[model samples]
Each structure stands twice: as structure tokens, then as C-alpha cells.
Target: MSILLSVILPVFLVIGIGFLAAKRNAISPAGIDGIMRFSQGFAIPVLLFQAIANLDLREFDLRLVGTFYTGSFTCFLIGMLAAVYLFKREWEDAVAIGFIALFSNSLLLGLPITERAFGADATQANFAIIAVHSPFCYAVGITAMEIAKAHGHPPHTIPAKVLRAIFSNSLILGITAGLIVNLTGLPIPTVVDEGLSMLVRAALPSALFGLGGVIARYRIEGDLPTILFTLSLSLLLHPTLAWGLGTAMRLPDEAFRSVVVTAAMAPGANAYLFAAMYGRATRVAASCVLLGTALSILTAAAWLALLS
Candidate 1:
């Protein structure tokens, strides 16, 4: 109960503050660029480096990694395909919806949340998620962007053009750096670790606040039916799929719940930006992300306690 309250309450309070502030017209998305750089370049890289550097890979479950990522990959593909079938919009928009529904902010909010939710013993599983987050985003996510471009404006130089589409992505870069250091058997000195910690401390608030700021500027356009239809897949479908798979794999209830419930979390790993940059329904994606993120705090925390 204490763990649930401790984890859920702070996040709720932040959202509450954000809701109030948005009502007051104080929020703006202009500072978003700066927040993006800070979180992507410095804060995220440091957090990943520290997490990866501290990890003793031998302590991790090899099968768990395979299971989790396999589940993630499957979920991602299915979401994409489902969006294609369901959306009356273009296929490119469908692709964007798919990625956002399946992927998450594994490095940013994921690491800290998993640590707080599951403690040190679960850290390695959390790291496994972090490790996959960037690579998956780059590989699958960039491909989705290309689909968008092919559907819209075509850039010069095939590969370079494709690379440019995803080049500005910092989360992908940061996770890659962390993986390199982790794989290289490098030792991070105490001073470097301390610096890393300081940077990581800002990741959650900046991102959540940035999201809140972005949402404050507009009202949702759809009626209840449209909103529920779009969001239900993210809130219900992916998590249920993950949960079914996790249980079949014999993951303990808590672990099963963690991975499954978090899958339903806001499509965190840069999907909204991808949608906006790619000229899909930008407002729709943004709206989905905001609502999904706010809803996830309750959904996830409840799942954690229930499973525990």
C-alpha cells in the first residue's frame, strides 16, 4: 500500500498541478525544444550510462529478455496492422498510431518508474527494456517515418534522406552510447557516476511537465466515442496481449503485471514528435499521448499493487 501510494501520489500531484496551470493559460510548447535537448542529450544518456555501467549482465534473465522483447516486437507489429485496418485516415497516420501505441519512454520515465516499482532485483529486467528501447525506436520507428515520407515528400539521397528523417532523435543516440559503454566493459569513475545521477534526476519532471505544457494550448476535438475508440487499443489491447504472453511464459504475477500494464502506458518513445514531424494528424497523436500518459499513472500503479 505504501509503495503504491508513494509512487502514484507524487505523479498524480504533478498532473494535478499541470491541469491547474493549463487552466490558467501559463503553459507553452516553445520551451519544448530546450527540454527536448536536455532530456535527450544529457539527462537520458547519463541515466542509461549509469544504469548500463552498473549492470552485471549475468544477473539478468536471458529468457526474460527474449520474451519481453519478442512480446514488444509482436505487440508493435500488431498495433501497426490494427491501426491500418481501423483508421479511416491514411496508412501513414495508421503507422504513426501503431508505433505510439506500442513503444514507450523506456529510458526516460521507464527506468526510474521500474526501479521505484520493483526495486534492485528487478533492475536488470528494467535495463533490458532500456537497452531495447532506443534500438527498436531507431529501427522500427525510423522505418515508420519512411512510410510517412513515401506517402508524402520524398527527400534526396535514399539512405541519407532516411537517416535525416531520424537523425534528430536523441533518445536513440543516448541508448546506443549506453550500450556501447556497457558492452565495452568500461569503468565509470565515481565522479562521472555522480554527474550522471544529477542529470537523470530531471528526466521525469521535465518530460511530464513538457507534455502537460503542450496539452494546455488546445482542447480535444472529438466526441467521447471517437476518443474511446482510438485510445482503447493502447489502454486495453497491447497490455492485454502482453499480459497473456507474460503469463504463458510463467512470469510471476508481479512481473507479468509490470510489463503488461506498462505496455499500455503513453506511447512515450518519441512517437508524438514523429507524428507531428511526419505531418500525420499531429493534434490527434498529441492528444492521445497526453491522455494516455495521465491515465497510465493510475492504471500502472493499480496493476502493480494488485499483482503484488
Candidate 2:
């Protein structure tokens, strides 16, 4: 109960406020888009930049990374296969559905929830997971998507397409720059660091609010089975696999919490974006993002309790 009240509710409250504001026309769709652009394109990237720039690379554990990503990939494959075989979706739609299961809301939902549930100091593992998140997911998703779309075209072009998609993201640019700074020990001026800190303060809250507005725009369409399947993979199976892997590897307590909590997050808006990008499974992707996020409130609280 405390976890629900203290950790989860506050995060959802901000999202709910945004949802209401948008639904009530208190915030225009253009205004909501502007907020999302500011948070996702600018503030969140700065937050990630500062976090990675100063992060102690030693805290990165191969076991932890392997555990989280293994679960993610497993969910992706399962989602894709089920979409193709069970639901009879197109190859392109299957790939998009697979991506919906692949990506989690690690930034907006994962970071804040872990920080509130654990402590500020325990988020390094989260940062480590996030550092490669967009790049890794985009690489896999774009590659699969390109391959599905190939239909006997030359395979060589797929690599370039994947690379272009990965590198073109602003988040990836921020992460790549952070890696350069970290590896090279480049110094950020004190003023710039302070400016980033200010942006960091606004990152999660604004993103959560914008997320709510975005969710408000998604009407829960048909394809109930596909949406439920996505929710199951994202909210249930992914985190379960993470928890089992973390335990098998005997991850440290902090790393265990980080991996499981992050895995348990709902499908991010990126899932819908990926579908929209390919113009496949857009309805299913949007419904999953909406319903999965709503369902994750209870599911996340349950995971936290079990972790405790």
C-alpha cells in the first residue's frame, strides 16, 4: 500500500493530470505535442546525457544487461511469432507488434518509479540499461522491419537502413555523446552541467504529463486479443523472465530491483511510433500503449511488492 501510494501514485497522478487537461481541452493537442517535443527531444536527452556523462562505468554489470535484454528479446520474438501464427497478421505487422513488446517505458516510468521505490543512489543500474536502450531496440526493430519489408531485396541495404534509423534518433545522439564524454574524460563546464541539471529536473514530470496527453488521444480500438497479448508479454512475461534471470545470476539487490522494475514497465510510446513509422499495426500498437500503461499500475505495484 505504501509503495502504491508513495511510489506509484504520484507518478500516475502527473500523467492523469495531463490526461485530464487534454481531455478537457485545458491543453490543446498542439500544446501537448509541443510539451512532448520539449521533453522527449530536449529535456530527457539532457537528463540522460548528464547521467551517463557522470556515471561510474564500473557499476555496469554484464550479467544485469544480459538478463534485462534477454527478457526483452524473448518477449519480442514471442510477440512476433504469436502475431504471425495465431493472429495471422502480416509480416510487417508482426514485426511492429514485436517491437511493441520489445520497448519499455524505461525513462518516464522506470526511472521515477525505481527512484521513488528504492532511492536516488540505486538508479545507476537503470542508467546503464537506458544508455543502450534506444539504440539497441531501434537496431533490432528496424532491422527486423527492413527484413520483413525486403521480399527478396538485397540484404546489404538493410544494414544501412538499420544504422540510419538508429543514429538518426535524438536520444541516441545524446547517449553517443555521453559515451564519448565518459570514455574520453572530457570535462563539461560547471555552467553547462548546472543547466543540464535544471533540464533534468523537468524531464520526467513533463514527459509523464505529455505521455498522459498522448494516451488521451489513443482510443481503445478493436483487436482486443492482440492488445491483451502485448500486455501479457510486456507486463507479465518480460519481468518474470528478468526476475528469474537475475536470481539465477545472483545479481546484487540493487541490480535485481532495477532490472525487474524496468522490465515491468508498460510499452512506451515508441512502440506506437515504430508502428506509425512503418504504417503497420498502428491500431494494435496504440491500444497496447494505452491499455498496457493503465494495467501496469497494478502490475508494477505487484512486482515491487514481490521484490520487497
Per-prediction RMSD in angstroms? Answer: 3.5, 0.7
lDDT of each: 0.63, 0.94
lDDT by residue (1-308, candidate 1, tens digit) is 68557765665465556556666756544565566567667676666666676667665555555555665666566656666665465677766766666566554445556666766566566666666665666567667657555744565444675466554556556656666777897777889778778887887676555555555554556633334555666666656667677777887544564576456566663667777777775666666766766777766676666656
What's the count of clashing pairs in each model shown?
Answer: 0, 0
Clashing pairs in 1: none
- Give the residue spans of candidate 1 off by over 4 A: 1-4, 22-33, 60-62, 107-109, 148-168, 223-227, 252-258
- Candidate 2 Cα deviation (angstroms), residue 112: 0.3
Model 1 weakest 10-residue run by lDDT: 221-230
Error of 2 at 277 (Å): 0.3
- Score candidate 1 by lDDT: 0.63
Candidate 2 residue-wise lDDT, 1-308, digit = tens: 99999999999999999999999999999999999999999999888888898889976799999999999999999999999999999999999999999999999899999999999999999999999799889998999999899999999999988888888888988888888899999999999888889998998999999999999999899999999998899999999999999999999999999999999999999999999999999999999999998998999999999999
Error of 2 at 177 (Å): 0.8
